[model samples]
Target: MIRVAVFNFKMLPTRAFDRFSLQIAISGMSNQTDDEEVHVGPDGTFRPTPQQAEDLQLQLDEVEQELHQAAKYGLYLVEKNEELWQTIERLHVEHETAQTEWKGEMKTVERHLYAAQQERDAWRLCVIPLSLRIPLSSRKCHAVEDEVFQLQQSLTAAAAAQITMQMHRRGSELRRSPSSDFVGSRSVILQSPPSLDIDLDVLKQAVDDKDAQLRQALAREVDKDAYIKRLQQTKRDTLDIIQQMKTAAAMDVDVRRSMEARHAALVDRLSAVQMKLDESQDALQTRLEEESRLRDRIEDLQAELRSQGDDVDAQTSAIQSMRHKCARLEKELQAVSELAEAASTSATATDAFDRLESFFNLTALGIILEHQHRIAQEQLLEGSSRQTIARWFREAVASEVPYHAWHAWLTQRITGKPRRRFFAKGADVSPSSSLAKAIADFFDKYRHDKKSPKRSLESANPTPPYS
Candidate 1:
């Protein structure tokens, strides 16, 4: 039975179970010493007495059962650890896939937005009211009007010249040929007839033809006057239409301005929504970092288990800690999902964001203030005179420097970024009102204190006085 137990113990795969079996054998042997002595065989081979053998066999059976149980438990832990690793890997892969999908979705959305913007611009151009598109220059209409006026003047002049010429010719013909009454009177006065003879009928026929010519000239003048009046009326109508178009164009300008304002508002809202999405992405990144930390912790636990498999309590505690971490991770994941959903739905979901922002703001403010305090202490420790330190702090508090200038100055001091040759200034460059206010409050608290002392003095410490 002893040989069989030894063989079974040796055949066990794990060192942990082997150690456990050795511990069991040592305890059983110790119990035998308290109970009775083992009998030795004559051939120099040791043999246990009957009671010792039975006790030894029973102990071996117990040890084997324990070894088997330990092996099974170890296998279970290994499998669990593997499952955890697989879960972590799966989660990591899912995170990467989600990020890729989100990026693709964002790109697609941006493309669609760009296309929509272009389409909107195209529609704005294409669907513009005619009033807005009305030609500003009336050169063509002016040229037509000028040509019509010139043509009317030329026709009127021609008609007048023809009438004048006809009148002149009639007057000359009447003068050359005397009237019938005048001829008769002249013949009576002369007693004898003159050598030249004048026919009265022929003179009357010439007078009638002249009268018909004058009538035709008057008709042509009347026709020209009527045509001129019609052209003038047409010109007046065109002028009225142009005036109405100009008024409509002015109204269209106002409408276009309003539409542009609305478009600008929409663009601002879109930018706000994009900012929200960026915040959610930041949250996701934080979750990934947490997951990485958890993975590292699990790997540490696994190493611990390999090195000290006997420490079951430590393993249980590590597993419990992992469970707690996993729960936390789950909660974080849920929060990230909520953030993303809110960001997608509305830009107005600022209440929750404001709370988060406030928390981070306070944390950052505390860090900055602490850093500045440490720097001040170091300066004092470096033997800077108390008056000089006080003067520097006073000067900083009194200066009217803008937040952006302060930010740039700090950035240069901390990161060694180079400045431009000429300082670029803008009104809307910086709006970290919270940080600025925090800084201002910090300064205001101790600015009035004139007692200059060393860094060792608690009261002289240049620290944030806020709770």
Candidate 2:
């Protein structure tokens, strides 16, 4: 009841006459001894005693002074509230500006992080393949060296065999002509022993055959020398390639190290930026909470002021708008955070793909290197043999035969089969005439003459026929 009466008192108009009348009525009612005692005049007006009227006037004066003081205080509160609202607006604007700047910085950091990841991935991809390739190149070199060594051994055996055959022919001649000096000037005009009855024409022909055999052997020796030189050159080339591969590997390692250092720096920078972003976000959250609380306080003050019949509806609507704005800003911040996270994840995936690409590139490089090495080895092996064959054809086969025909004939001889055609399609040689058989027969006669003791004797007994 007292609370209701105080509310009614505050709701009353600040009028001196009205307050005085209310006081008089209250005093008259309190002074009544019984409920039946009359407190009102016949004219329906409250009649008070002189003391009650003076006391009511004094009470009226006090109430008017209190009302004036309350008005001044309310006005001061209104001014302070306006200043507070201005401060809140400034703080909200600053918060929004800071949030915008933070988001920009986050985006920049994310881009940097992504670039760093790509570089790091590239480094990893390049390094692993280079690391594996070094050993493979070394192995290829070793294999090439082994193959060259084998070729050299075969060439050496061929040379030794040729030397032995020459020595055997010389020894056989010495045995057949017991009195002739093998290397003296008199041996140039050889004479037959008394027991041998050889015809002059037969001996001369035999001597010509032996000379041809010796020439053929010398030609073979020359071919061997050339073949050895070619092998040596191939070996040198392979060594140079190996050295280059080593240099490339070393360079790759250095590049990888540099990239790693750069990546580490970027990671540190990214981490620092992330930390700062987190701190900014946390500070923003705290500020938002504080702002929310301030808004609540303002809303409470506005409610109180509204209850007191103050016009604060416009201010309340502005505060609500600010709340909506703050909520929107928070959502934007969350979206930015999600974007940063997605960027980070995408960067990670990009790095993985880069690594995979590097792996594939390395694998491709390795395959290419293997293919090149194989081709080089084949070329090295075939080059010397082809050169040797070419030299043999040039020296042994008369220049009358075209190189293609000689090559075909040689191939047929070595393979022990007839060729489709030894000469070009339009050649004058009949199809029935086997060029391969002809070459084989010539080589057989040449070999037989080289081995025959009669030929050796005729060659060693190099004297002019008995005239």
Candidate 3:
């Protein structure tokens, strides 16, 4: 028993259980402790192997720490449930009270409902007339209409901005082109005729003068300003087109929606009218049946009167009833006529749509061209300042022409690519021949440009040789 207690001591908690187990072992008694955290007794306690018992106690301690947190969360949820239950009970009590009140008012409500039913029947019989009717429109239409209007406004503003930018760019370009008083720069100086063959001293003076112009141009940043103006204009145009597209987009989604709403309202009106007509027809049918039965009764009464010697009171009452029946039938027929007209009109109005604008408003070439121009400026190129001219030339041309090829044609020269690349097998190609051909083509193009400059911003009219 002492050895058994020593082995069981491993299951102790807080090291204190181990001490108690040691005492029990020495005393030769197996007794449990009073602590609630751990109960070593046989009842409500699991006995484990000594190794298992030690592991279980360690796990329990870790779980107890976690339980502290879980208890708080559980308590919070439990409190919430209690509050919710209380609220539900309160609402249930209020509902019971309302039900009692409703029960008390039921008689009055039934009286009103009966009155309405009689009134509706009278309308069917043409005794009471229906004047006011609901129109086919939705509350949501107002909300969406405002948003579409705003989008249209924004698109219009964007287009205007683009137009302003274009005007400014043209103005600046006009100013820069062919200004006799304008000074030259290193860039222009380098491009000047290579035949100058001036001695180094004379060339140096021209270089200095050109350098001064370059400095002035740089400080003033005319190129940069022009570039900025062009870019802004392009962006404005794009944004405007996008705005117009947005309006179109809004209109597209709304077109169906507005129509649907109108359709729904019209359908509702149509349904209401149909219901009214059905009611009137049903009443009319009933009246006709009654009149037929009355006619049969009158015929039978007349036959009886002829057989009887005296029946004046009965005859008088029968005649009055027959007249009332005829009058009721006439009223029903009128009601039926009115209801049929209303139904036909409703069907005609609900089933059709009317156009508000001329056909093909969006497909106009001018709008498409402006739209394409704006998109190209904003998305394709960046910060060239020559964006208008550059983008137009680039996209308008055929894709088969390479960019370098165009540039080579423009400059009347090619570098970084020597003519030797093109060859007859085992034979050397002459650079002079390639150069000569290029020069001839350049003159030809120049002559064509002089005849008339095409109104394309992108196509360069190489300046005509001064006559």
The sequence of per-residue lDDT tens digits that candidate 2 reaches over residues 68-100 is: 899899999999999999999999999999999
Model 3 spans > 4 angstroms off = 1-221, 248-256, 305-467
Model 3 Cα lDDT, one tens digit per residue, 233-317: 7668978999999999999999989999999999999999899879756744643453344345434443543454354453454
Q: List the residue pairs that clash in candidate 1.
A: none
Q: How does model 1 fare in lDDT?
A: 0.49
Candidate 2 vs candidate 3: the TM-score winner is 2
Off by over 4 Å in 1: 1-210, 240-269, 290-467
Candidate models: Cα lDDT each: 0.49, 0.49, 0.44
TM match of model 2 to true structure = 0.25
Which whole-number lDDT from 0 to 100 does residue 34 have in model 2? 53
Q: Encode model 1's per-residue lDDT on 1-467: one tens digit a residue.
A: 23333545646556665445544544445334354555666976456577755666677678678877998999999999999999999999999999999999999999999999997886565454534323322343345445555655665566557556755665565567658655654454354222112333344455456555555645654564575556557658868999999999999999999999999999999999899879757755643554354345434433533454454563354334334443543454455446644564343233223222222222222223223322443432322222332343333334533323444443343223433411353222222233334434433332332122321122232332121
TM-score, per-candidate, Cα-based: 0.24, 0.25, 0.22
By summed lDDT, the worst window of 10 consecutive residues in model 2 runs over 458-467
| Per-model C-alpha RMSD | 39.4, 59.4, 57.8
